[model samples]
Target: MVEESAENVVPPTKGGGKKPKSAAAAAAEPVATSEAGNSPATESKVPPKKEKPPAVEAKPFTEFIQQDYLPALTQALADKGVSDLQLNLERAKIAIKGFETAPECSQVIGRWNGGNRQFNVYFFDDNIQGQRAISCVDLGHRASTLEAFVIDERKVTLDLLVAGVVLRLNSQKWLTRN
Candidate 1:
């Protein structure tokens, strides 16, 4: 086998490869002169970066609560004979007026799986469900405690809402909190 040539090897940069060149640095490159002939420049030529369009700003969590989640959550609760519910827009939450023994007592906007999808999670003892979730059996379910189905935005139907309230009554601290 032929021995590897040291001349052919490129030195590794601190970033493990060619560092990204800024647009300003690329623009500051000297103009090539004809008299310079075929002599190579010290800096390696870097391709100009493509300019990207400004990203559209997305509406905030509270906006989602007011617009999408609140409507669905309100209707779901109302359909299940929950008449005293009120939406707290300032806090981006909802609570029942005359409810005793509130578990899953409040709901706030939350995301799952790196924020790929939007969803609502509940609060236990008025505690926010931030990064916490429960199993799926409580949607009109009785005694299937082993199969825990985490709440997701797509699965929060009227049936699940009723079941979730019931489940929240027996809410256990998340396994992680243990």
Candidate 2:
């Protein structure tokens, strides 16, 4: 009779139809002896840790427009050969004749070339994440107005806001020198 090795020995199954564990699987498994039989303890698996999202910059719209946007826009326009560009922040209604006199307007007007070239950005609300209407009169001619929303959804940072306005103006050739 041939001798059987301990590694090749198969554990008896209750139903007598279960497949025996292989040598590698039996060697890898932990041996536990209970009162009546051998049983493995339940595995406790720890879940993977989740990564956090980046923080957004929360700046007040009016403050950002006044303190950050205006200066950056001025420099950007000046760099684009707009030397006479003038920027004004006012609270009044949007009108050609009485916009400067209106008390409820939330707008910033940029005028260059002796008031002949002008564009006004009218804020619908105090939040940059909302809407803004831009009306431009290029060389005494009214161009089609467009609405702008928050360019970056993640944050309302100064650079993103300024870049949005500057890019819009640049794309429309609104601030280009003639």
**Which residue runs of candidate 2 sit more than 4 Å off their true CA positions?**
1-57, 96-105, 141-146, 149-154, 176-178
Of candidate 2, the 10-residue stretch with the lowest lDDT total is 38-47
Q: Model 2, 58-164: lDDT tens per residue?
A: 54666767777799889877877779988988876666543446445478888988988787877767666666667767777754554554544664666666666
Candidate 1 lDDT for residue 103? 38
The count of backbone overlaps in candidate 1 is 3
Question: How high is the lDDT of residue 7 in model 1?
Answer: 57
How well does candidate 1 score on lDDT at residue 5?
82
What is candidate 1's CA lDDT for residue 100? Answer: 32
User: Each model's C-alpha lDDT?
Assistant: 0.42, 0.69
Q: Lowest summed-lDDT stretch of 10 residues in model 1?
A: 137-146
Best by TM-score: 2
After superposition, candidate 1 runs with Cα above 4 Å error: 1-59, 89-130, 133-178
